[model samples]
Target chain A: MYWITVLVVAIMILSALAVLLLPNLLAAVAASSVVSLALSVVFVIIRAPDVAMTEAAVGAGLSGVILVLALRRLGLWGLGDDNHPRPGDSLQGSGDDA
Target chain B: MRNFTSLLFAGGLGFFLLVLAADLPVGAAPMVAGEGILGQGPEAVGAANLVTAVVLAYRGIDTLGELSILFAAAAGVGLILSGMRRRADQRPDPEGGFILLAAADLLFPLLVIVGLYIVLHGHLTPGGGFQGGVILAAAFFLPLLGRPGDSLNHAVVNWVEGLAGGAFVLIGLWALAVKGDFLAPMLGKGALGSLFSAGTLPLLYIAVGLKVGAEIAGLMSTLQETEAAEP
Candidate 1:
């Protein structure tokens, strides 16, 4: 049981790390949801069905929607850094004005 | 350039996780069942779930502090956003489809009712304060996204919060008066799996759910108002 738990925990931790480390913000967010869902499973295994339910709802469900909303608010949903100004624009003084 | 910062953040997080794994138990927490009413007292604390018992009875003060923290955050958000109010720059959705609008309107009350049900039966079932509270906030938020200019009445939110807080304290005091112990079980301990078991835990979870819902809704409204005010 302990070894299985360790494996699951390691997978969750790695997935969460990938979520943070990945450059694709949406992928990162999806990874975060995966991590949360996995944690809920862990909670259930520990005889905390209530906590597991709460974790799944808030951490996985609500927060996923909220993060997507936030990402939309910030205009970071689909487009990537391809639209950013060329690095030389810093010398052109367009960088600091905003 | 942004990727560099993200990488650094990831590395730092990984380091922290390693430290946590080294220190904390990585396996299942040892489950030691609490001595039931026979060892403690008559189980009438207004809850049926033992988890609620640990949440609101054993750690009542901690839960209170958590609620206060949420309240403070709500207040801080309101203060910060209300001061920055301007004019609405974004125009209301003129092309809002009838289907979308109707769906939102139809779902709002149902969501609120479900959230309230979860809050009310927190101790009786597998839901509780934080979960129901967040759901309640979402019920309000869903409409805000669909209907542009709609806003919550701040007064109603204040009343909800005030009443919930007062109820929590009053319940605790009543326990003290009746049982000679603050936060003691006040209701009859019915059958072990019944809804009326576990004394005061259910009541506390309800209070917590209401308080948290009010706080989150208030915070969301404050932020939304500021964003709406921005032109």
Candidate 2:
């Protein structure tokens, strides 16, 4: 039980860091989802199944969808949109950095 | 200089968070109102899942407020996105590929079943209205993602949401007029841990499930429909 708790917490921290540090915006969003999934695991280990289900469903699932849709409106990524991010477009900061 | 200052600020914040985390309980849930609830919740509320007791009986009105908040947020988004609705002259984005379409078709029914199970079994299990409702919304939204040009009937969606919300309120009002307390668990609680157990709680959850499912689907559909027009 201790090992499981430690492992879930570790994954949560790592994915949380990755959410901030990832270069690609979509990758960052995916990493954020990972953070949520790991946190849900932590909730289970803590015997908070209600919170775990909510975190998994809303945080990992719905929030990711919302963020990805927001990315579309903000002109970050899409399949055939006119406002697709250009190759030289730096995701985080000045376009020159990439 | 500004970068240095911000770095110092960030470092201080991190240190503060570390301090906060250091003495936290490792795996056990904190005993607060929960200790008492865990002991007597089933006897008092007759819900096998104590969380349902706390949510539906002890603090049911708060849940009602939460539902209204979600409704307001969805309405706000609709108000903002209404003007951005895709015009007939403008082209909508093409549907997703075969795999996405197939996945949507295959998964929708399965997801709906799982969502309903979670919602209906909430009194005996971990998940309830909110969790299951999100899954239901995802089920409803998947096909929309697969076929971006296709649209759900908004009028039907509106009616479903309105009726669901009204049902929730009417249930609370019925409890009020009958039991003299708003949102009190009424009817028979039945045998504990059974599908029919927990009286009006399951009914409340069903109303919540439908309302949240409709609101979330409506919100996501609006977001889908209000995409930037084609160049």
Predicted candidate 1 versus true structure: per-residue lDDT over B1-231, tens digit per residue: 898999899899999999988987657544455555324433444355656766787667777788888788788877866665435675432323466678888998998898988877777777888889988988887777666477788999999998998888889899889988777666766666666666666677788888888887777665555533211
Root-mean-square deviation of Cα positions for candidate 2 versus the true structure, in angstroms:
6.1
- DockQ (C-alpha based) per candidate is 0.20, 0.33
Worst lDDT 10-window in candidate 2 chain B: B222-231
lDDT of each: 0.74, 0.88
Off by over 4 Å in 1: A1-11, A72-98, B1-46, B89-102, B228-231
What would the per-residue lDDT of candidate 2 be over residues B9-116, giving only the tens digit for each residue? 999999999998887996684899879988888877789998888888999999999999999999999998888887787666666767899999999999999999
- Listed for each candidate, the true contacts retained, as a fraction, are 0.36, 0.56
| Residue A71 CA displacement from its true place in model 1, Å | 3.8
Q: Residue A64 deviation, candidate 1, in Å? A: 3.3
lDDT (Cα) of model 1: 0.74
> Of all true interface contacts, what fraction is found in model 1?
0.36
TM-score of 1: 0.74
